[model samples]
Target: MPYSSLPPSAFWKLCRNDRDFLLSDIYQPKFSLTPGMRIATAGSCFAQNIGRYVRASELELVDTEPAPALMPAETAQRFGYGLFSARYGNIYTARQLRQLLEDAVGDRLHDCTLWQRDGRFYDGLRPNTEPEGLGSEDELRAHRLDHLRRVRAIFDTADVFVFTLGLTETWTDTDTGVVFPTAPGVIAGQFDPDRHAFLNLGMGETLEDLSAAITLIRELAPEIRILLTVSPVPLTATASGHHVLRATTYSKSVLRAVAEEVAALDPGIDYFPSYEIITGTPFGARNYKDNLRNVTTEGVQRVMSVFFGAHDGLAPVDRPDTGLARPSSDPDEEDAVVCEEAMLEALAPK
Candidate 1:
C-alpha cells in the first residue's frame, strides 16, 4: 500500500486524492508557476474558482469581462452573481469555446456582424454586452477586426490558458453554424427544431476539436500550457429528455472521458480531476449543501486539501481585499443590513 511502491502509471489511481497529489508533486508554485505569469480562465462556475483562488493567492488573474461601476456585492446581486468577470454566461461546453476562438481568429466561415441594440454591441455568440450601433457593412467589419485584435492581444499575453470543458451538447445557428452557450429556447428565444441541432460529440470528434483549439492557442502563444477540468457541478437541465438526473450523469460521463482522452494525446495539456475529487464515491454522498445539489465548503475543502497536499510548499495566501469594506451594522444606514447579512451569512454557513 506504500505510495512509492506503486508503478508510475498506477500512481494517479492509487493516490489518496489526485488533486492534492498533483498539486503537491507536479503543480507546486516552484515547479508549475512563476512570477509575472498571466493566466486566463473560461468555463463553468467551478472554473471561476480558479480565478478566485489565484487572486486570493496574490497571483495575477486577467479579467476579460467589462466591469460595472457598482460595488462587488451590488454588481453581483444585480447581475445574479460573480460580476467583474464573465461567470453566468454559459461556456457549458468546449465546442462553444472553440467556436468563440474560431470567430475571434476570423477563421469562421460564416459572415457574422457585431450588432448594436439597446446601446450595446453584441457578439452574436453570447449577448453579454449591449450593441454600440449598427454601422454600415464596412464599418461593422472594421469593428469585428478591432474586436479580434483585442482577443489576440489577450491570447498573446497569457502564459496559461485554464479552460474548463463543460458540456458536449450545444445549440448551433442553423444557417451560419455558429454555436450558442445555451440553445435558443433556454435563455430567451424559441427552439426551432429545423434551425438548431444538438451536438453530442463522440470521443474522436471531441479530441479533434480540442486538438484544433490547442493548435490555435499555440499559434498565438507557443509557451502556453492548457489545464483542462471537467466541471463537477451537475447540469440544471438536459436536452436529451432522459429524465434530468440521468441527463446529468450522461453529460458528465461524456465530458470526463473526453478530457482524459485529450490529455493523453498531448504533452502540453494536463487534466485535473476536480470533478472526481468532489463528486466521486470516495467522498461519500452527504457532502453537498442543503439543496442537495451544490457542493459544500467541506467538499471544496476536500478538493483543496488534495490540491494543497500535492503542492506542499505553496505559502498560504493572505486574506483578499475586495476593496469593499464590511458594511456597518447600524440599522439607520441604507443598505447596511444587506452587507452585514451578506457577511454574516457567508460566515454562518458550515
Candidate 2:
C-alpha cells in the first residue's frame, strides 16, 4: 500500500480496526474550544443537553438573557430558561432556526403566528415560552421582541455556536406557507386542515435554509465558529405517511447530509458526529434511554467527552447532578426538551 492511501486519522486506535470506526476518522474538529471561550447553543432539544454539559464542565458557556431571578425555578423551566441562550424552545427545523435569526435581525416578521388557547394568546412559535400564556397580545409582542433582540446579541458575540439539527418533520400554515414549531391544534388552537398543512422538509430545502442561516450568522458575527451536530434521538411520530421507523431514518439521513454539506461551505464551520457516535450500531445503542426518544445520562456524557477530546486544549466537563439531565428528575435544570411534536401521538384514536 502506498503512503498516500490514508490520512492522519486512520492511525488513531478507534480507526485502526473495521468495527471500531466509532467516529475517530470523521470526528476531527475544525477548531478547539478553550477554557474561557464563549460558547452558545441553539437548535433542537438535544442542543439543550449540549449546553448543560458545557456549563457543568465549568467552561465559559454564555447565557445572554437569563430568566428573572425572582421567578420560581419551575416557572423558569416552563418559560424556557437554561434551555438555550434564548427562550425559544426546541427549534426542530432548519427553517425555524433561520427564521429565528431573521426575526432577530429585523429582516422578517411573523407576528400573526401567535396561537390563541381559550382566548389566551401563546406565542405559537414559542408556545412553551410562557407556561401560563402571556397576559395579553401586547405582552406577548413585548416578550417576543425582547427574545429576538437577545437572540441577535447571543449570535453576534458568542465565540462558538453549537447547534444540534433535529427533525425534517414540521407542520406549517397552509395559506401562508409559514412554519410553526408544531401544529396549532396540538398545543393551543383548533386543528383546522384548511389552515394547517404538514411538511417533511427534503434535503435540498433543508440545505438551502441552513446555508442562509450560516450566511446570516457570518454577516452578524463573521468570526463565529460553527459546531453543527445532528440530534441522535429519533422522531416521536411522523406526519409523513411512511412508517415511523422509515420516517425517522429519512429525517436523520437528510439532516446528517445537510450538516456535512453546509459545514463544507465555510472554513470555520465544523460538523460533529454526535449522531454517528450514538446511532453507530457498534456503540450498542447505549446512548438512548428506555424510551429511545430521550437520550440517557451516560449518552450525554459520552458525547461531550468525545466533543472535548476531539479538540486540543479543552478540559473534560463534569457530569451535572442527575437532576439536570432529565426533566423528570429536576424540571429546572435538565434538557427540559420542549417536545411539542410528541403531543401528536395522543391525537391517534385507540
Local distance difference test scores for all models: 0.57, 0.79
The sequence of per-residue lDDT tens digits that candidate 2 reaches over residues 1-350 is 77567775556553646565645456777886777788888888788778778777646677877879787655666678877887878898999988888888873457557667766888878787775687788877887888888888896669988888999999888776778888776777666788788899999999999989988888899999998999997887887999999999999999999999888877899999888778877677677766666777777777778887776687777776533333455322234455666666677779
- Look at candidate 1 and tell me the lDDT of residue 169: 66
TM-score of each: 0.72, 0.90
Off by over 4 Å in 2: 2-26, 70-73, 322-336
Candidate 1's TM-score reads: 0.72
Task: Tell me the tens digit of each residue's lDDT in model 1 across 1-350.
Answer: 57668554356564445533333343322236554466777776556556656556534666554445664754443332342134224366767667667766874424442334444444444433221333454554564555455556667667777787766766777777777665554323456788777766666767777778778888888888887888776665556657757877877888888887877777777787778777766556655655445555456555555544444344454323333355534322322111111121222227
Candidate 1 regions exceeding 4 Å error are: 1-4, 7-31, 64-73, 76-88, 107-124, 128-148, 318-350
Candidate with top TM-score is 2
Write out the backbone clash pairs for model 2: none
